[model samples]
Every structure is written in C-alpha cells, then in structure tokens.
Target: MPNMGRKLRVGMVGGGGPANFFGGPHRRGILIDNSAELTAGALRSNPDDAIASARDLFFTRGYGDWRSMIAEEAKRDDGIDYVTIVTPNDAHFGPAVAAAEAGMGVLCEKPLVMNLDEARTLHQAVKTAGVPFVVAYTYTAFPMVMMARHMVADGKVGEVRKVEAWYPQGWLAGSRESTADAAGQKQASWRVDPSKSGASGCGGDIGTHAYEFVRFVAGLTATRVRARLKTFVPGRALDDDFTVLADLDNGGVATIAASQVTIGAQNDNGFRVVGTEGTLEWSITDHNNLKYYRAGEPVHVYRLGGMYNYFPSTITPFIRVPEGHPEGFHEAMANLHRCLEWQIRAKLGEQVPDHMHLPGIADGVAGMAFLDAAVRSGRQDGEWVDVEPVG
Candidate 1:
C-alpha cells in the first residue's frame, strides 16, 4: 500500500433530485473529511434534472445516463475511484452494479436494494470484483454510538440479555393531510409504491436502521423474528408501522419497532441494551451523551469526546473536543466519510488509518434478510420466522 498525494476523484449516481434530504449533508461530509472530490455524477433519474443538479452541486462534469458516466470516466487518465448511489430503493442496484463493473469502489445508501434477491446479487458482484464497498448505515458513525458499541464489546455491559430499539417519525401520522398537496404527494408517492420502494415501506426505510443499530452495538445476530406490520392510514399503499421480536444467536432477545405515524416524534431514533451487569442507552436526539449503568451504582454519563477511563481505541478519532462541545449529526456523517476515504486509499494501494472501518456488504446482506424475514413473519400473523444467516 502506497500513499498518494492527491485526493480520490469521485462520482455520484442519484443524489440530485427532489427526493434528497440527506444529499446535501453527504456532500458536505466529503468536503469536511477532506477525503474525496465530486468529479462527476449522473445526479438524477431524469436526464434534465440530472444535468441541472450537476451544475448546481458543482460537479466538474455531468452525464444524463449513469452508464455513460462510468464509460467515460473509466477511459479518463484520472478516473473516479468511487461512485456513490443515493437513489430510491429500486434504483440502487443498477447504478451500484455499473459502478462496480467499471472498477470503482461504491458507497450506497441503506437497505442495499429493493429486496433480498437484489441485495444478494449486488453483494456477490461487489465481492467478485473485490472492490471496497460500504452500506451507509449512518448511525454506526456516531461518536457516542461508537462508544456504546465499545462498552458492550469490552465486556463493560457483561453478557447481553435483551435489547430494544425504535425509530419514530410523525411525518405520516395523517397521510391525507400530509400528502394532500402536490409537493407532499410527490414525496410520499414512490415511497409507498411497491414498484419503486419494494415490499416493505417504513420497515425497509427506518426499521432497518433500528435493527442495524442494535446489531452493531450488541455484536449479536438475530436468528429468528416474529413481527406485526400494519398500515394505519386509509388508502396508504404500504405498511407504515412495525413491531418485531427477535431471537438472537447468543440466546438473547431484541424488540424493534419503527413508525412514520408516531405523532409529535421527529427522528426519534434510539436504543437501549441490558446485560447481566449493566445497561447502555443512546439516542440521535441527544447525540453527545451515552448513559451507562452498573448494578448498585450511580449512573455514569459518557459525554462525547469526554475523558473516560475505559474508552476503546476504535472510538477516539470521532471525538474532536473534550466533553460537551456537542458533536452532532454532521460529525457522525463525517466519520463515515473518513472511513470510506481511508478504505478507498487502501484500495488505491495506500496504508489505511487504524480507525477506518465501516459496515460493508455483509451488513447489507443481513439487513435484507432481516427485512425479508420480518415481512414474512408479520404476514404470517407474528409467527416466528427463521432468518437465514449471511456469511
């Protein structure tokens, strides 16, 4: 592995469109980390919109079609090292596959593809190409969340016994009222449509986030799941809420839920894990503090970038300041960018920094399996369904 003086050239596939809320944040993350540059992109599914977004986003070049971007970029002397896919659920697989086939590494948004089959195929393609690939499970990059994972893995929480996680949003509480207008209607349209977003709706969108959070923190795999899924709004095309009970491989249990109809809650994503000796709790709303408890002792607060006697090596870089400066969502996203940058550097034959690891293909496969099994279990009236382990 050799270090190069220049930054990695990058291209994007579906980030510029009406459907993007996190696209701007992702762009900012890249610049903040000093990892890569937006060299080119096929920014939207629509050709005109793609060209317009490229200029607005300041890409050096733009393409109406993703395949054209790949073909042209691959022929350049200074080619793009990575391509990011930030499209709707159904659009992820094609661009990712094209990017991989063109000999570029990839970072794709969550719920890897529309279904388990697509996920498996994409996973295989990345593996066969031997490219550095990552699924953007954004919460895994949070500093406090990383601290919580370190605590559990270091045996500070003892043997994990149970876990609970949820993500509640109020956006879809009254679908008619929310999507009655054209703007809201467009935003809510493709998400609920099966052809574009796949089988499960809210679960595929946010429930996977909750499930991924628990698995990442607890270091456990769910072996079986029983779920209840429902669509609370009339005429809504997909399930907006879900409750799932998971049987872990380590003989533990996890309860998970996600809903867009939880009124008054906005991005309330959090989780709690209990073990034989103590418990760990953290949430997105309170991004900087992690609550830890031990039996018969006062609760301990582990502030972000705080001096702690037991902090692990993997969590330190994300901490920019001493205790209480408040590193929030952007920092979490920047951490992910830093990790991907290091991995891309490694792929280009450079030495990667020690703390540069993020979730990869395996995590995406697991997410898909969880989604499929949960939907199956729910449809079967909460009967327990065995989740096939992804190797």
Candidate 2:
C-alpha cells in the first residue's frame, strides 16, 4: 500500500453528549492505530451543545449541524477525508446522503436508514458520488469472526445447512421511558420512540447485528423471512423483541433472534453455523474463542492470535497482538476503521491488498432489506416475506 504518511482526517456527526453510548467508541476506534484523526464534528443536535462539545473534544473545527459541517469542510484545503455518523436511526439518512453527494467517504452505523426506500436512495447517492462507504458492522471485523467466515469458505464446515444468530440484552426488561422517574434516560428515550427508532426497535437496534452476523459468517443471503415482532414493555411504541425464520439463498434455513427484554442477558451476541461436516459456535461474551464441533472429533476452541499455522492468511492483518493478549470490542472497532482507512487510501491511488475487506453500501442495503422484511412479516401476523435484493 502506498503511504500517505499523514493520518486521514475524520469528522463526526451526533454522539455528542457525555452519556452518549457509542460516541466514545467511535472516537477511540478511529484514532486507535493513529491511522485517522478527529478534526471536525457536528457532535450534538442542539446547535450550541454541538459546537461546545466539539471544542471540548479538541476538534479542529465544529459546526452546529451536519449540513454546515459538510458544506464548509468541502471547501477547506485540509478538510475531513471522511465522516463517521454515530447518529440515531432517523438521523442517519440525511447526513449519509449529503456526505456521499459531496464526494466524501461515509462510515455510518447500521440499520442504515429509516426504511428500505431511504436505504436505496442513499445507496444511489453513494454509487453516483463514487465515494468509499462503510457500514459499521462491528462484530464482523473481529479476527475470530473473520476466521469463522474464512473457515466456512474453505469448507472446514462443508455445505452450510442451518444457522442461528441471537443478540439479547436485559436493559429493556422493564420500561425505560414509561415511568415518571425515567426522564434522565437519554439513550432509551429516543430508542423506544417510533419516530426516532423506526418500525422495530429491538430488531432495528441489535437484531440487525444478529442478522448481519449470520450473513457474514455463514456467507448466506437471507432470501425470505417469517417474523414476529412484539413490544413487551408497557406502553412502548416499538417492538422490544424480534424473532425470525429466514430462507437462505442456498436453500439452507436460519433462525435470527434478538431482544432487549431478555433478563440477565447483556450483549450476549452469539451464533451457531451447522454444516455437513462440522459446526461453528461463537459468542461476544467469550469473543476471543470459537468453538468447533464435528461428528467424530472432540470439541475444539480456536483462540484469536493463537500461533496456529492452519489459520487463513485473510485474517492475519486483523490480529493486532500476540496470542493470549486479549483484544476486545475497541480492537474490533479499530480493525474496521483500519479497513476503511485502507479503502480511502486505495481510492486515492494507493495500492491495497485484494484480501483487504470492508462492508459497504450493499451491506447497508441488505441490512435495511432484512429489517424491512422482518417488519413486514411481523405486521402480517408472522407470514413469510421475501427479503429485498441488493443490486
């Protein structure tokens, strides 16, 4: 790869408040390897708060909103090379489309937009602008996840038959917005609102992660879905629980489930891939290890960064440290940022390895399609619905 020598400049949108859950992770992820620098941002929806927050964070420049940020940045000689959007679901489409239209790279959080139509429109904007775009499917960036993906591709698990992916959290076991005393809950406030969270809350929030996880590891496209989405929390507007049975393009079946109401579960994102020859099991709680099972062989655990010569070459770049050192969420996020940096460099005439991978507009569209199908299926009383294809 060609060395630009200087770090890629980044601008951020949303994730401004001190209590913002994902803002810090994104900032850390982009700067973790010194590959990118946070130079600008429109950090909050409130005009005054946005500027103050940006200044407090030592951003080179700040704007009250994303529009001014993009407009002014486009004119600067040392403008941001890309923008990372950590906004809520409803805020994603506008900035993403605007950034792409301005010919700047975009890295946006998933459940891409409010609806499939918005997703397709955003996709068109990206395609027309010819900018490098990435969706923050954070889990797939994990080295072990990449290893699992490669294992399936190499036929370590032959002809995938069945897949199961689930993401459960206990935070919404009770109403976070309903009670009179819950006013200080900033994160859950907008999340349970239909206008802000869109069609399905839990499904849009973490369920997209589970659905994408299945697609990434099993290398299967969800073709159809039969889904049930329900809101168990009293007076909540959006569904807090989601379950789906999906038909894969290869004729295999998958069960994808996610819930915020599952008591005692905390970020318990996991999956099982069953194939003709073997099975692969993995969970975020024990992120560094992957469990393998076959008919006649004993259960095996593949640890990340293990000095295993059998590990595929594709995953080598993702491993940041020696074996047993323990890399986790932040590291996984960094891996993604690294790939996105490489992609941006590649676009600017740098040579990049063919094996270097990053999920882009297509992945975003597919995720939206999954959410759309699931929502439609839910509305129709669990009737099967086909997932929209991504071109």
Candidate 3:
C-alpha cells in the first residue's frame, strides 16, 4: 500500500473501566506500529466514567456511549479512520454495525457477536459500507501461525486427515465469581452470565479460537458437529467446558475442545494437524515455534524469526523481530493492527498486495456458526448437528 504520510486516527468502544483486562492490550497493540493514533472513545456506558477514562488514556474525545461516538465522529473531518471494539459479546453487534454504516473501519474482538444471525447482519453492514473490517482472531496473526497456514497451503503436510485443537484455561476452575476480590469478580461475572456473555461461555470465548485455528492452518471446514457443553461451576449460567467432534469437509475429522475449568492450565492453547504425509503441531505456550513430524524423520522445529527464509515470500515481510527474539500476544495483536492499517490505506486508494492473511467478516460469521452448531448439538446431548450455512 502507498504510504498515507500520516497516522490513521482510531476510535474505541468499551475497553474502559478499571477492571477491564483487554482494553489496554488493544491500545498497546494499535500503537505498536506507530501507524495509528487513539483519537476517540466511548469507553464506558456511564457518561462521566467514559469521559474520565478517555481523558486518562489521553484520547482526544469521548462520548457517553458507542452510538453517540459513532454519530459525532462521523461529522468530524479529523474523525477516526477506524474503530476498535473491545466490548463484551452482547455489545459487539450494535457498535460494529453502526461504525461500518458510518464508514469507519471496524476491528472487533471475537466470538464476533451473540449469534450467527447477528454475525451475518454485521457482515452485511460492513459489506454495504465497503469499510475495512477485521475480527480480532488474534492467534491467526502470529508469525508461526501464519507460517503454518503457508505450509499447509503449500502441501507440506499433504491432505489433512485429523485435526485436534484444544484450549484450556484455569481461571474459572473454581468459583472466582463469588469468592475472589473485586477485579476477579468483575472479569468472571459477565463471562458466566448468559445475558452478557451469550450461550456456551467457554465454547464461545476460547473454543472459537481452537476452531478458527484448525480452519486457518489446515484449510479444513467442519460440515457438522457433535458437542457436549458443561457448566462445572454450580450456579454458572453458561458452559465452562465443552467438547466438539466435527466432520471435516475433506472426509477428515476434528476434535476441538476448550475448558475454563482445567486446573494448572493457563492459556494452554494447542493444535495438531495430522495429514497423509506428516503432522504439524503448535501451541500458544511456545508461540514462536512450530513442530513438523514425519514417520521416519526426526521432528523439525521452526522458530519464528529463524524460519523467515523458509516462510513463503508473502509472509516473510510480516516477521517483525530478529532471530531468537520472542514475540507473544502483543506482537500477534500488533500484526493484526498492521494488517488493518494496510487495509485502511488500501481503502483510501492505495495498492496493496492481493492477499493479506487477516480474518474478516467471513471468519467472524464462521465463528458464530460454529458456536451455534455447538450449542444446538450440546442441547441435544451431543447429537450430530449441521453447522448453519450463514457466512
């Protein structure tokens, strides 16, 4: 893309309040490339708190709510070029649709929205507006993850046969909602509340990550799913653990599972894709490396920076650091923001490369479809159910 010669202005919805753990990361990620500036925010639902939070973060302007921010920002010549949505699951649809309709690019956090219907609607809104849109499927932006996608597409793993992806987080293993202090309560409360977090909490929250990982890396699509959702915490309104068995489109099968109730597991997200020729494995725990296995050969471990020469030409430019330097969550996030920045510039008539490996509306809709299928199957006692054709 052509250099715009100036930083793009950014707005935000949610990501405010003292207890929000996600907001700061989004902010830090957006600024990491120095390609964008945080200009405005509807930081909180409360008017005064919103303004106070924005001021604290040094945002140029703030509004009482997302609607107002979108409305007012649309009228300004120096308005935000895009909006980053860090809101809860339930709040995603409205601001995302409104921002797109107002011609602002959207970078939204996942599970996209509460349901597949909302996901499609938001998808249409962005399509109609022709604004750059990105769903924050953060892991897909990791350098190793991108390399895996390249390898799979290059037929390095041959035809995928079995995919196993799992994410286990221990934060909600016990009753943190009732027993922990204020910050813990604030984080755990909404996630366990159906009205706020939507159906199948753990499934929608982290399970989608595993599902998306399989899709992005293995290039496989799940045609149907048999799932079991469990709420281990006695009074939790949503599932804290879930397992899904899916039939892949290529006559392969997949096992995707997630648990917030897994003791000693802290973001232990991993995936293994077995193909006709070999197996490719990755884990967020070792975010920078990937392991390739063959029956008669020793395992080949590829580190992020060291694999630059081995990565496809299309992806080598996205590798940000030197060899042996570690890149983690923040770098992955910044990669997403960098893609968004390039996309935003492209929307301004700059010529960008034809392919940018960032997740967009379709990926968002796919996530919702997976969640819907999983929930339906779980309700039917793990009976097989077709994934909705919505995206």
lDDT of 1: 0.84
What lDDT does candidate 3 reach at residue 30? 92
Candidate 2 C-alpha lDDT tens digits along 1-391: 3456678999999988865778899899998887789999999989999999999988889899999999999999899899999988999999999999888999999878889999999999999999989889899888888888888888988999999999999988887665554433667878888898888899999999998877788889899999999989878889999999999999999999999999999999989999999999999999999998999999999998747665676677677788879999998888877888888888888765555476788988999999999999999999999998988
Specify the poorest-scoring 10-residue window by lDDT in model 3: 348-357
- List TM-scores for all candidates, in order: 0.95, 0.97, 0.97
For model 3, what is the C-alpha lDDT against the true structure? Answer: 0.88
In Å, residue 331's CA in model 3 sits off its true spot by 0.7
Task: Look at candidate 1 and tell me the lDDT of residue 134.
Answer: 78
lDDT-best of 1 and 2: 2
- Tens digit per residue, CA lDDT, model 1, 242-322: 889999989999999999899999989999999998999998888788899998999998876646545666667666667
Query: What lDDT does candidate 1 reach at residue 236?
Result: 80
Please give, for residues 125-164, the per-residue lDDT of candidate 3 as tens digits.
Answer: 8888998888898989888888888888888889999999
Please rank every candidate by lDDT, starting with the best: 3, 2, 1
Residue 165 CA displacement from its true place in model 2, Å: 0.2
Computed on alpha carbons, the lDDT of every model, listed in order, comes to 0.84, 0.88, 0.88
Can you give the lDDT of residue 58 in candidate 1?
A: 96
Query: What's the true lDDT of residue 39 in model 2?
Result: 94
Candidate that beats the other on TM-score, 1 or 3, i.e. the better one: 3
